[model samples]
Target: MNRIGAHLLAGVFRGFGTNAKVIETYEGLDLGKEFTSGKECFPCIVTLGDILLFMKKERERLGNRFNPENYIYFMPESDGPCRFGMYNKYHRIVLDSLPGLDKVKIATLSSEDAYSLSGLIEKEKIQDFRKAAWLSIVTGDILDRLLWRIRPYEREEGMTDRFIDEAMERMTESFSKHSSGKDLSCILNDLVEIVCEAKKIIDPHIPKKPLIGVVGEIYVRTHLKSNQDTIRTLENYGAEAINASIAEWINYTTYDQVR
Candidate 1:
């Protein structure tokens, strides 16, 4: 019976429906229009555009092997500081507008409560905690570094996006097979070492530059258009600007709550 179950499981995994294409939708929205006029608004349309682009790329990559009906796009939501709590609704609305995407699941992870779609998934597969933690850390780091580096170089026509996409693909492939507790620690250490090396590689220039600190709603700070090219404008004026990452913010918030 065990052998039969193993064979069946193998068959299922080999099929397209067995593997889910998880879409990270937290940073998908680009809410630049609302922030331009100093408006405290949530940019649902921008977020929708980001998700659509991701879905299109996924479909192209997987072709017939992509099981759109079985895939899930995870969107994290919170109920504080702004109207961001409605991000899931906005995401669904936007997703519905796109053709052939009616069946895609747009699930939510709420920061306000302990119970969330992600939490439930994690709880149901309790033994997969190690895998989940490793994924959350590694992907969060990679996205953070990529966003920080690419945002500054994005122009009307540039190759930063292509570079980022390729890097993300590589990272994702590497992450899939590495989730054991020992492996997770080793990966985290390796990531820190790499970042340190990266800083060294780019440390030769101490140009007299202005330093600007960007702070605001998560969407505004990360979205290029929302801050009205604030970072670019700062760089144009010979300033080195920094945008704190949402991942770091979340990590700190979680840590503080535990304390």
Candidate 2:
């Protein structure tokens, strides 16, 4: 859920009978270690560990109800000279070793396949999906902004967090109800008010602590396991730590198109 858009995207996919999820794995470094040879790239290592964790947890909780068909991994691919092209293959090799999970589908939506695979979805659903995807991306950005604006200056711990959860729940509900082309501004306005009311900010009269900016590799920056929980540790020490949101990457890519 690093992009945050994926959380909402999962709902869109769910409407099509595909149960998709975006895993923002925690405490997975050790799990990654246990599952991999330590020679894999950090992203691959972390992803493998998280997938393993999901499979294990599902198997435990669902018992016989968990079906591999219901748990597909959506790994989008590109025509690459880059090693990213190999991720799904490596994932398959590792996953085949685990019983019951060997049948879990690793579905790749490659850049090359859009034309050839367009028929996999109905035309009507594709239009609806486009609309849902747009809203998801925008909503994620709003929620992320709300967190940074409120959390650091929150008058009470957890109150801002509570509003965030409620806002997201309502936002998700709104998205689920509308398939396409409904004006989201009405719901969005309500959400903004909810966030503005997260809590009172710290008194501006008092001296403020130093601010820290986290800057580095995108994967390391997004994954707490990869960064050794740097942001949370900073927040715990009474300073505000700001990291660029994943929306920054989306905007950067979009900028590249125009330039």
Candidate 3:
């Protein structure tokens, strides 16, 4: 969401200078509930709502320093029959009428659009983007799983959360250092050590908690904002909430492509 993370993510731009930002906030759902039609899909409503809230917050922060020209919406679309394919057009249509938003640029990577429309982002950059993106997702998914796995069982209520935050920041620092260009083997060793240390602090003989499986839409299930921290809430209520694994989506995507 901030500089180092964005640099690691967008570094795939091959100096094309793009940044990755994620809208993961509970405030977005509040905005979505107000602005979006009730008929819309929950994920769509949250996505649109997050952008709107982000814009408002940024405007407040920037005040006189704000410039619409500096911001660009990175809304990628998939080659699918789902309504998600229209989000880019929907965003454009909606933003066009909003004051001070018409001038803002949108970088859409849809199957039907000019994929290489941005002169700075080209074929080789696309390959870099793909590799960086996969690493990002895999790293993030493991971190999420680790947090979820240990949070419920921690000796102290906030220990797991605090440790995960520190670990993530450390990971960001590693990413910002561009460790991928060098011997990447030692890059995440500290994070692995942190997780191991965390396991040592947890009570080994704590009574087993009841397990609950989470099943639903991919975004809602895995995303904290969309799901309203349901898994954490369940954990607080004395249960182990097992979220769908990242592998599920990967396999599903592969299956979709093949069949």
Instruction: Tell me which of candidates 2 and 3 scores higher on TM-score.
Output: 3
Candidate 3 C-alpha lDDT tens digits along 94-199: 6776899887777776544323334436655565445444455556666777777788788877888788778776766565454335344544675577668778
Highest-scoring model, TM-score? 3
User: lDDT by residue for model 1 over 166-254, one digit each (tens)?
Assistant: 44444444344444233455445544554443342232334445556777776666655556757667766666677665556566556
Q: For model 3, what is the C-alpha lDDT against the true structure?
A: 0.64
Worst 10-residue lDDT window, candidate 2: 111-120
Candidate no. 1 TM-score: 0.59
User: Residue 87's C-alpha lDDT in candidate 2?
Assistant: 69
Candidate 1 segments whose C-alpha is farther than 4 A from its true place: 1-42, 52-68, 93-102, 114-174, 180-183, 203-205, 225-229, 251-259
True lDDT of residue 66, candidate 3: 87
lDDT by candidate, in order shown: 0.51, 0.65, 0.64
Model 1's C-alpha root-mean-square deviation from the true structure amounts to 9.7
Estimate the TM-score of every prediction.
0.59, 0.76, 0.80
How do these models rank on TM-score, best leading? 3, 2, 1
Query: lDDT by residue for model 2 over 1-259, one digit each (tens)?
Result: 3444556666556645455566657545567678778777777777777777887888899998988767777765444354555667888887898887789878765544321224434666665675566567667767766665566677777776676777776666566555344565654666667666664544454456678887776566766567877766887787777776655654554454456
